[model samples]
Target: MQLQTPHLTLVLISLLSLNCGSWAQSAFTIDSVKLTLLPGNSVESGTKVTLRCDVKVSHSFPQLSHTFTFMKYNTIIYSKNSSQAMVERSFTPARRSNSGSYQCRVTIHSKEKSSNTETLTVRGLQTPLLRVESNVVNEGEKVTATCSVPEETGPLQFSFYRNQQMFMILTSNENSTNTSVEFQESGESDLHCTYRHMEFPDSSNSSNIERVLIQPVTIIPSIKVQPGLEVVEGDRVRISCDVLGHSKNGYEVFLTDRETLLMSSPSSFTHSFEVNASSSGRYVCKVETGKTEKISTAELFVAELLSRPVLSMSPQQVFQGQMLTLSCRTLNINQERITKADVKFELYKDQHPLKEGHTFNFTASQSSNGNYTCRATAKNITKESKQLIINAKVPVSPPVIRAVGQVIVGKPFQLLCESELGTLPISYTLLRYQRPFYTLTVSGPQRSAVFNISYINHADEIHSFTCQAQGGAYSRFSQALNTPVIEPVSKPELSLGFPRGQTFTEGTDVSLYCSVQQGTVPVTFFWYRVGSSRPLFTSRSSVTRGEHVIRSITRDHRGKYYCGAYNDAGQTQNSEPVTVGVNLAGWKKAVIAVICILILVLIVAILVLFLKKARTPRKRKRAVELSVKPARPKSSDPMRMSLTLDIEDNTAVNNTPGVMGRNVWSDHVSDSESDDPGREEECEKLRYTEIQPQQPNNPEEVALVVEECVIVNSELQDGTQEDPDHQTTDSVEYVQLNHCNQNPE
Candidate 1:
């Protein structure tokens, strides 16, 4: 029973697995979906049509349901869920709105498929009929027009045309439409109407043409002038507006001049007024009735009573103290009405009455500069002429030329040319060397003209500028301008007052010279040291060269020096540097000299003891002695010294000014023989000597050792001074001294 149970369980599990595999693989798919039009794609209106959607399915299941959707122009028109493969939608009477692209969609198990689109065009529209209220109508009068399409659907548009030209369009949901239209043209016009369904605009038909006779209303008004078209001033003129032909009742009349209403009255159409220059224009007569207006025009000319009085001056350009005659006259007059004598003339100055006559004479002055006019009167008619402006000019005096500021060389400056007495608009000329270089016209309230001088090379060149003023016919010249020009100082040369290669002693004066090649006078010179910004000395000189003396120069002045020169030309030129060397102080020089003398004295004392030891006998023990003595002052020679060594007595002597001497003794025992045993015993001696000055009164003289000598003295124990037989000549040495004098200045 266990074995059978296992077999049964296995079989059941295998069956369940097979069922699941089959279910997963059985997916419903739509094979094809097609849309077909029953009565073909193109059909006439009122014909029955049908859209059929056929869907073919391929599925593992025998029964599968599909959702069918019928679409027109992408919009779902009919939808249904059914097990059938084919679905149909019918349009009993196909209209223009039903014509569009038709498609079908089949959906099953969440999978959808669309068919190819097919266009169903229904082409047909009922022709409309056009009718007018009246066959004949007056222009500008409204008439009723009716367009009817009896079998058409709703939402239709009707267009009305006049002589083949569309004039009005109306949209309505009904089969008929009517509107009132006004015709501007007066003639026979063929009117028609076309109707189109809103959904199918391309399907439409024009109605039959209806002839409408438009009559034009002609009621032209006539304009009449009572005083004729051409009338003189001060004459009464009457303008009348009347209709010449038949006009409708309740008509209004208007009399106007240049579109300005002069009179508007239905009972009376006449306007009367005095004619003047302003009234001379085109007059219009207008008549209005209902929606029609008619007009007639006539021109009127108003002649002047007398010509306007003209005020004239004898001379156009009037100056002060000159004869200026002003005359007022009428050029023309109405000879038929009044002669020239009958016309009276008056003159005015600045709107104030001046005189009453045909002519007025006066001399033009500053007071005469004003606006002038004249008026003429004849037969109660008065007219004034245009204003005349008169300006009495004053002759310009001589203009003076002056510098605007201090003139500098190689810099821009201005020169003003002004006249004290002159009228406006005076022409001033800037002359250079008697020739005009620039001319400026002074206008408005400005009385001076400025000339810019770019640069000047020399001081004398400024005298060439002159100015001249001219007003009206009078002109004058000014004197030549004399302005000083300042030149820039050139690079200065700095030098020392002392000679070259000379040392600058302390407490001496140092002079720094600064000179320029070319510069103006009154140049300031500044002296400066190296590495210093402030000047050590400053001086102003009127010449080309300036000197800055540093009083009592010290070692502090021992450095590089430079100088600078400045002038009115606004530039300072610097000089090249010069080096100064200063000597030591007087007390320092004396201290150095004393130290050197002490060292020389010590050397001389040591040399004397050496000589004493050399002169001793070999068999005898000899004693060497060096003697010291206080230095005695030599007359007029303080820095002199003397030292001597006598080998025969074994003695040493020393002499030095302002120095204490001491004795130095030594014992020496020797068993060796001398190198030159046969030499003379008194042949050589050691001596330090001083040569006396040739000029003892000269403080600048000093002794100096020029040559050196070496001496040797040999003596026996018996104190005998003799030469050996082997030495034929004496051993003598010579020392020479030289004296030099130096000035301390």
Candidate 2:
């Protein structure tokens, strides 16, 4: 019974006409109570429980309000007032201490009476009982056993047992269900469990005694390969023996190299141990899991670390391609099978891998002479051999003794001694008979080494150095190699185009010649301008063929010039500058002289005509001048004449000169007058512009009359000079007589 609200009396008064009982007015009474519990419904120890209480209410009770008391057997466990029309009591789940009868009593305020109590029997699964469902178990399989219940209406609690020892206890549950205890794989053992109630008066009980018999679990131990087969001291060697598949149970693990045991564990486990020189061996392992003690033994060969293998030569140093047999060995190693030795030998020369071998027997090479060592690779181990230095006694490769040259005095010239090839790891001691007179150190591991010292005044035998390369047991000194004590290449002195200090003109007799003072090898000549990039005047080119041939020169073109002498060895020296200068003085003077002569002739004729004009009737006469072409004029046209002034040049001078300026004269007036004979009057009367004075005096320059009444004595104006030398020819008078003017002024 329960109360819907706190004011039960006030609610009953509002609904009822009057009070029936004197002491219990407005209070409802319950006639009876019944509590029914579901099967397997109980609580575990230290847990909660719920008791459902149903009350019957009719018209006899107008309103109901009640207080309830929860009882265990005959004792009152709890008491409380009902907050609703029905009453429900909550308690901790069933446990051993709480296993007893549970009942609830209700007092009704509406009926003004107490109801009879209802009871429920609570129970729980007991503890300390172990069991297994299956009769037989296989290896490497999960081991399973469930807790059991003896006899009870309450929930069950479970506990697991293995090998007669308690392993785990399971929480209680509702049914007479099979609770399991699991193992990865079956092992020789016993199994059981305990079952109890899930809810309370915290009450519980356990199930019956059960024993589990597992069949033989076959464990086959498998070998495992440890990582880093090659290692140094203090490295961990981990070995494990685990049963394969379901046979993981009942196995013992062992660690070994081959057959020797290093570690062991009672069950499947990994065994790790730090290793050192004393811990080298072949390894395997075995296990005993069940009925049969599985025997799987592996060979563990303990390693006895030996000294690193070293490669050595009987004769340390020798000539290139000399017979060389490098004997290599690691001390204290059982070398029956070099493979078992577990150490590989590396052959190194010139700081590079020459070969990888167990032993060495081969010819030495020029390239083979360098830092050499033998590296022994043991099983997961490395040891560098002691320097076996095969001093191939390469005589230090003649100490490629190079002499240092300088224009300064007393500055010690270093004679670099180097060997391109020799036995390796060779230190060099340089000895020169001079201040720094004693031995000086040099670089090397090879046959060659370098030695440097100051104040080496002996240029003659300056590089006379004795260099020794000591390798292994062999040592040898080298004969000094001389660098030919050559002087540095000097700029070849050059002279181009004849007369020096002038420019070169095109189409002139340019002689590009270069020479050097005391030069080695026939100096190859090259010519270039002052500011130009490459050589312009090359050796004997198609364009530059002739020597000087001009009697007197002109200046149409010119430029700067320089030259270099060289050979395959290198550039030698630049020759002294030779510049050709051309003034065109001769050309201008000759033109001026011819024009002056023609003027004088015209003046004389004009004077004679003036006198004759006074003497004669003074009749006007018209004249025509005709000019003929050089070769042959067409038959329809009259032959024409053109004056060509040929200025000769001095053939001895071959220098090129810069062209300063030029003067242009047209022949149109003379040609038109000559073509028309009737125009001779105008031609005779024509007064041409006067010729300029000769060019100023220039060094090595002379000017004079080149030709007068310039005739075609040689050839066409465009043709080549008739001859390089002078050839005198008969001259015809070419006097222009003026018929228009005769004066005596």
Candidate 3:
């Protein structure tokens, strides 16, 4: 029963959940949306049309509002929010501008859907009427052309055509437009007009053609050239222009050679001119009356009278200080009219007149080089020959060769070859060891040529480079260029004065030698310690080897050592590092030895005196005791003390000035008098000696003496001994001996 109840509960809950899900999913959904064009997708202009938007939607709710939108060319034209799904707009008369892509969109809540785009095309335009003001017109006379579209308005572009070719276009807001055009020739032309709506470019139509007739001018001009149209240069020629028909309006006539007006007169029609080669062309005669003009043409040929003088030069190649001759020659001429003597000749250099003759002669110097031409004139006609260029060659002087910059072995460098005086183009050859290795031709005002030498194999070997320049028939050689090449310093070898595996002692002089296998002179040497960037010593030497000496070396000088060498070649080469160790100086060792001996001797003397006292101590009831007072607390103070021995009461007391009435063994006495029961009182047998304090000349000696005494006392206190008294006695004796040694005076 329990299981069945649980299953039934699950089933009921699932059913309810599914129902809620279905309602949520179907809250708002668009089933379909469509845009339709009424009266079909394509229709004639002025026909009634409609754009409709239809949408179908499904919703869970009983009532849901939706928006309907209609768009043309992606721009919304109509929109409405309503419960209904269908919406529409109508155009009473469709216009060409109403043709385009249309779309509809429907929105419900947040859900929206758009319909596929549909196109509407309204085609048809009114045909324009073409008209002309006159059916017949004279050539060059303007006639009016009118294009009208009575049914259409609003800025229209109208195009007018003549003989099927459009010649003019105009825009007007009126239904009719007109323009004036002229025909250049007398011929019948077919004229038409076409108009397009500015708002809807596709709305265009053409009108029927109109025919117009053109008439020729009444007065036609005739041109006649006297002496048949052909004549030699420098000959007189006359041209006449006359109207063929008589005119009461008194027409004017013009005579022209090509486009240049020679004569224009209403009473005179003849023109006389001396013809030259430049005057040969078509001659035109024109007549004008009222708005009409007529023209006739006649071609004239003017033969050259002296056949263009030709300028020539003797010995095509001219050199400085040599004679040069220039002559003018002519192939043909009208000898019957003009003789050789009748024709005058003149020469010009660089546009300046030089001489007048058939031939000219001058010395070819630097000043003579210029552009030359000759002129021949006869019968008021002049002709010039083609330009002749003259450049007198100057023999090349000795060329100079030099290095551009510092030369280094195994590197590319440039060498320049130049001449002080020479005319380009000059050929240059570079020689190495008297053998040509490179050649080049230089021109265009560059006086020098540069040659790049890739590399030199040997730095020490002598190499000579020379350059030769040739401008004319002969070549000249430059002086040889010789310069030493710089060599980079080789890796240096570092050596210490001490033998291998031997340590250097402090306060000894040591030398560090650095040498290179091969390098340039004036080499610079540097000494450095390992793990350091700066050099300890630096020296410049003319040889490859260098040395650095350290006087009175100290432990501070201990570390790794290395050397570096560099020359003009700019590279510093370093040697492998060598380790150096420094030991203590010999004088310090000797001082330590003397201190040990003094301590040993004092211990032996104390034992001997104790043995002597024990041998006779029982007979004499009093015991002798010696006590030494230590110096001041300063570690550097000399161990100066006074010692005295007492033979009564077995007690020793120091009577020194600063330590009077004080027991020298005060610490030991305090221990003996302590309350500890384990200790037993014994007879005092240790002895100490008193030595007087004395001032020393050297403070270092006093410090050494103090140090020795301190060492002896510490050793005695720390010694493992069966008898504490014996150790105490030894320390006292050591102090006494050290004081005595310092104050022997």
Candidate 4:
């Protein structure tokens, strides 16, 4: 315990020294050290000013010594020991070099520290520095002015004052020290800027004055050429300039190639000029608006024009299936010189493009026979040559001559000539016996011709015919052919070989012959009815004779007949109508003859009977006729006599009375004498009564009557006949069955 006190004291002292060392390394500082210029922070050059430095430290230590040092822009000018911690100095006029940043230094215990920096700006009004972007700018270009005050706290508003008037205003951002303003420089203007603080609006200072001299701005015109940069020679080219945003009336546009002027116009934007060999070069367009000028340049090339093309054919006339060669040539002019390598050729057939080459070759045919032309082209120029016609004529073969109809006398015929596989527009001629008969030209490829012979006569038999074809420059002929024989037909005469006069009996043979005097052989005969148009019979004969025969004739064969003869040459007239008559059958004729003979016999018998009757006596005829006459009753009587025929009495005349007996009957014979007393007339009417002795006075007659009565009574007593009803009138008995004959003498 006794030894620990000294060791503790040593340890405490060592720790105090270590704490003081650490504090001395980091705690040494200069406080409240200031360097100021009397009156203000800023001043003009050559001004009287006072410079002062005040220094202070954070801790006062007995061992800590203080010294104050004043410096001007990092160069020490005064040093002093400031027991009072203050020092002062003075300068009558400050130099421009002394107007930079200044400082005050405080040193303690051999360690020195500096104060915050302070700046002093000593400015002189002698020609403030002015920077103009460009003295000669465009009229609308911006001209900026920057006014600065050194080392001043400011949110400055800067204004451009032109000729003492505010031309523009610009406000800087808060706490910003930038004092620049921009103004459009137009015409002549004296410009300057004044920058003032936000707190002191009226307290401001101007920068150096500047004169912004502006000239008229000329816009660069856009220029271009029409029809592109490549142009054909002798072609018109248009060069145009668009002078936009400029006055249109006062501008003059000039177009040129290199230094040579091509065209110039006032107040115009476009100009047209012909391009030639001399026009191919760099072209320039200059636009002058008042005193200002702008220009643009371009390069142009002018191609030469092509000359007319020439076409040539190796052979003018070519045959079919043969090679044909055609050549085309043209002159290509370039820069006033002709060159063939620059030109191209085109061949045309019938105005249509055939090929594109200098020479063309192909097998020729009929379709290739047309006009051919050539065309040449160089750059943009074209020219056509004269047309050349090609003839691909094919040789014509022998013509085929054909006869269309039969070659006979008095008949028309047609001969045709055809040439196939030949070229078009061929001419043909038909010759008879080497003489030209007809000539014709065919327009199309069908090469055919026809000739008509109006009438073929006997003379044609000795003639020969031929056909010829001509195409272009070639001709061909066919072999001769002999003409055909021709004979005419003559009228026919029809004859019938019959014993009867043109008449034939049924079931008999008959023949008709038709003969022509001057007709061809192998003639055909036609038999027709007289009124009919169709033929009833047809016969072919080797000679000029035609015959028709009928083995058995019939009624149908009886008609008017005519015959016609026709040969290959022509037809003859029909023969006259021959009336052919057909007789009836044999049995039919015999029956008609028997009937006629029987009629004659009957007529003769009738005549004989008439003669016998005529030869009889008239009295006997009257007695026979009166025997049948009836006795009519008198008018006062209503009774009539009736007679009945006795068929059994063959010996008596049993003939009934005729109409004449009835007409003159006894009833119609009236006794007119009884009705009229004027005259006495004997009544012819008689009645049947018994024949008595009429007059007793005549006894001889009575005696004869009695004798007759005795004979009658004796005949009656035989009883061969019965007595009729008898009547007794007055005192006499009458027999009604008997009549007295008027002629009973």
Candidate 5:
């Protein structure tokens, strides 16, 4: 027996252990199970997988052991220990090495029971990363698809879209990448690729929305259109719209007048409406799209045709060749309401046109006196303005020149110039030849020129005066003339005399005089001295003789002088001056006395010599008588003639009155012969009777001979007293007689 001694011990121990468990019970349960996956739940690779082993309850000291295990597809993947409230568990993502399912298993143990088993399911994950570089494809290009996996590299599929609609798909390897299908040209499409993963999810999304736009064969529609200004009547207007594209069909165009459509067409659109003044409204354009129900619109404004333009008048009436202007205006319109072509205008006189084209301007003249009109061409139309009438004025004529007096001096004469024909506002200018005299201004009432002056004193004055007239637009002037009038210079009075030419000895004063003959005004007088180039002194004229006196004359003052007088008019000629020479003291008187005395003394000496000569003649006569005594027996002495001699004058010798013939000499009667005239003759005869009648050889004998005698003493009748200054002069004249012995006895 191997140990028979323990049979009773083993049976007793087993019953005890079983008996204790009947009194104590166990408390435990399956807590929970949580599942996770890496590309394992319909997702991609490179993702984490989480496994949770959660317990709801646990008995203290009675819970012995807990076991948790993770599995994939009934295969163990991972596991962990758990007690009282269990936590979670995790697993890594699987590549090609982990393509399977996943689950969880729990084992529990307590004091009286054996361990228990609980099972949960798990799944593995698998993923593949794939990409395609180019999805859009032009024509005739090779297609390719590239797929990449961490465990194995392979091929993929690519597709394309046309106009956002799918079209084609393709598959390729890394050597030849995959892309969209090939065609003849490019177009708009979308492209994507397909990828398969053994470790993760089966497919993936695309890179981005791939768009490929193609050059299309279709056309595009037009844009909007508008107008700058309003539409006008009769305008060949372009009802235009803004459009773009090469498609030129299926378009409808029309022009509108507010709500009403004036013209419409599919082919020919805008109306070139030749409008009149009555045609005008709001305008616009309407169009339709090509082969579509769409509409394109453009609005425009057609303004009312510019009111018939009119040209007007200011002073419509004027003379021919007068200046004027005509103004043209567009009527019945607001400011700037129309465009350039809306308002048409032109000017005309009668039917003749002014400007070649449209404008609001015109010119007028004297010849422009007719019905005037304006031609207005607005839009595509024309009109003629209302007619305006004009009247004209004529001009006046020029007048003749006239005078009021014969003379135009001393404020008494007047002259007038007038005009019968000239324009209004005529102006006149009075002139003496080219020299201006006076001026006159006139409009209508005052149109005359008057000249007035008096007192014509000039004797031979002459002048030719003129007047001229001017008015509107008279480029030249009209003129006329009158007679002429010279004045002479006045005469001056004069006097010529000296104050006292001889007051004038050495140191006294002397003057020259000047007086006017008939003049009354006080006259200025001047005295001129000779030897001087200018006047030595000056004086003035008065009622009395004007004297110019100079004091204390020297020797140099002995020169000529003259006096002159002057008034307001001018000066008179000078009068001659008298000179007075000055000498030293008493010398002049002494010289005169001495000259007279010497002259008297010479006369006395001359008388004495006359007496001596008288005596010699007597002696000669006595001697002659004595010599003749012897010859005449009866010779008696009687009164005989005696001789007189004037020694001062030898020419007085023949001047005795009785010498030529015996007159008063007689013989004395008492002395016998003196009483008888015959006896006196006989005595004289006998006295001369001869002694020796020969030439006397001795002068003593000749001396005793008597010659001739002079008698000066005579008596006047009535016996007036004889002047003592007169005395008897006895002079003698003796000659040698020849042979006196024969003398008459």
Candidate 6:
């Protein structure tokens, strides 16, 4: 026999493929289940919830040998056994009959189903009432309080507290049933409130502790300022008040400063008032006694008086062997309680008495020259000050400062200054190296002072010239004329103090300051290098300031570089052409920091190979051999049903829950349709067909998917199945399964 007829046709095709996979898993039923909940069914009573149980399996049995229980209202509450098509249960403080009905049965291996019972309410939050429109409050009085919560709990959030801390948070309005607040006392104790539910964890319990007393603080009325409050502006101050023990026949008093009220007395203990100068501020002293009113403030401070006597004179003009100083101080305008009294000064001269106390030393003659007058008598006031004349003069010799012309390079020169005799009208001053430049004032009596000297550079050749001669407070100087050493050459400027866009690479250091804004010193400076004619550096600077450093910069220190500036009046000035390029060295910045660390390690290895191919886990889509057909070509109302699928492996096609749509799919597909190859060949010939309608203990029926439409072709549409204008006309045929989180075993 030909190989035993091919091993008896492969054992009858392996016993008809194990009897068609045991009749596709015993004609799989137990199709619909679901019971979810997890974080919501309106929870909150002590929190912790869960519940799960999924199990719907039958898209040609992609896996489902279940056994989950759960229940809740009919009792059970959790029983396992899973090949898992989903199962869970938690609870934690969840009671109140764990909130009514919840379902979830499942079973599968022998059929069973259940689900849809749902409910779960669990509320519980209500404990916050805190009231107090009054329980005694009178320090600065106001105390309101309120709080509430428990109007069937919904939009809460209050907070208040006080002796236990918190203090105010009442949000105010979401149907605001309570949550007031005024609080003003200085002593209270225990007050509370605690509503919750705004960011929910549903809190509420802390509200019945009201104890609040807060009363103390009424004793004010004391004001007493007689010789006090530091008065003194014509002082006679008295302001008293004292009503703390009240009585004077229903009191009255008054006296304010919180913006004026000044005086009102009647319950007098004293209230004189004199320290004026706008009485300086904060006063008060209330009293009232009728509806309980007692104030008391106090801060006065007046001061204001003296204002005058100043007189000063040291050397205001007088010379004959010099010596004269006169001073007389007073100034009070409120010398803080004014007290330095015994002062007495007198000077007069054209009117006779010459001098008496608060400082007066004299020696200048012409009989101590004239028109003086200073008086000042304190304690009883007498102020005179202001009248000083004093002209004693006579003495002016040392002058003779030279320099007269033609020391040229540009003309103009004349200094002259002369005073070798004595006072006629002095005041000269010309100095140069000692720096005073020029001054001349020989009023009317002529004592000589020329000073013309127009412009001469080279720092005027080491300057030296002097002359000075005043007369009254006598002044004299001279003796330093040696200035005239052949001067003139000015013009030299060359700068490069570097650092400004600086770029000198190879071993750095490049200084260049060759100066001479007006030229004078030994100068010299020279630097060149443009097209090179020699002289790359040379310095001298006796003071015209010069410099030129280079330490290392190679390639002949790059290009264009000017500088020049010579002196000794020999003339030379060039500067203004710097250039020197070529930078980035240090081994080319260490090879550009090692090529920017290999281009940031090749962009972090291409972003770690695109995040390890986006955290791996892909390659799946293996089984694909679909071929279905079911035709129904051109026929308008024949109730359409044209299906023709032929997938073999452009794999990846999914639609989960019993495969494809029976009305619930669209979590908007596209995980890029498994890397899109035309959407993975239109998701490998997608297909769907639907027709559910078999209730009897409903477990959500309609299954058998390959993306759905298992096989249909009917036509019905003319409303009336209990009309709400009902209409119908169905004809389907779809397929493309496998997606329930994939690995469906």
**Best by the TM-score measure:** 3
Model 2 lDDT tens row, 1-745: 2575658877887656444454344444355676644332454443555667666644343454567666767587677776465666665454454555666666655333334444444443344434455666554334445444433344544545465576775554443444444444444555544444555434333334454444454456776646655654536666667666553444566666555666788766777777767566566665655434444544433454556576777555466557877766777664542454466778776567778886667677655556667787755566676655443444334344455553222444565545565445555566665222344344433344445566544335545556655544445566654544323234654444444665534335655555544333433566666667876654532221212233333463355556666543343456555555655555667898999999999999998777545523311110112121322233354423233221222232222132122112114344456667656434333322122334434443321111211222122221223321211221212322211111211
Cα miss at 70, model 6 (Å)?
22
| Per-residue lDDT over 1-745 for candidate 6, one digit per residue giving the tens place of the 0 to 100 score | 8769989999999999999988888876666888888787988776778888787676475665577888767788578887878878887766433566789887766778788988788787656677777777655455567766534334456777777888677664452344444444456678877766653465667878987676654445788787887765666887776665533475577877777787776665666755555677788887654334557788888755554577778866656777888887777645554556555777777877776876788788777777777776654545677777777667887777777644543446687788866666777878777778778788765568788877554434424667788876668898876564443334544455655335677777777676665655666788887888898778786776677887877655777777777655455678677676647677888999999999999999999778446423221111111222123223243222223233222212322223222222222233433445675444334434333322222222233222122221111111112222111333223332332111101
**Once model 4 is optimally superposed onto the true structure by TM-score, how far is the C-alpha of residue 310 displaced, in angstroms?**
1.9
Give RMSD to native, each candidate.
16.8, 32.1, 19.5, 39.4, 46.2, 48.3
Number of the predicted model whose lDDT against the real structure is largest: 3
lDDT against the true structure, each candidate:
0.74, 0.49, 0.76, 0.65, 0.47, 0.62
Higher-ranked by lDDT: 4 or 5: 4
Clashing pairs in 3: 626-688, 641-691, 642-690, 642-691, 643-689, 643-690, 643-691
Task: State model 4's lDDT.
Answer: 0.65
lDDT of 1 by residue, 324-409 (tens): 88888878777887888888888998889999987787888888889999999888888898898988888899998999988988
* Per-model TM values vs. the true structure: 0.56, 0.30, 0.64, 0.38, 0.21, 0.29
lDDT of 1: 0.74
Q: CA lDDT of 523 in candidate 6?
A: 68
Model 5's C-alpha root-mean-square deviation from the true structure amounts to 46.2
Rate residue 86 of model 5 by lDDT. 52
lDDT of 3 by residue, 1-745 (tens): 9879989999999999999987776677788998889989999978888988888887666777879888888898888998877888887777665678999888876789999899998888767899999989987788999999776656788999988898998999888999998876898999999988887756466799899999877676788888878898877888888787655656788888776888898843788878888888988888877667788999999888889999999878878988989999777888878888888999999999999998988899988899999998888888899999998988888998887886777677888899888878889999998999899899967888999989776774325789999987869998778776777788999988666435889998889999999878889999999989899999999999999998999989888899999988788899998888888888977887898899899999998678546534432221112223232212342322233333222112211122112123222333323333332112222223344544444665455445444443443344315335433432333424336332110
Clashing pairs for model 4 are 632-667
Worst 10 residues of 4 by lDDT: 656-665
Candidate 4, superposed: residue stretches over 4 Å from native: 1-306, 314-317, 321-391, 404-413, 458-463, 480-489, 497-503, 515-525, 531-535, 538-547, 554-559, 565-572, 579-600, 617-745
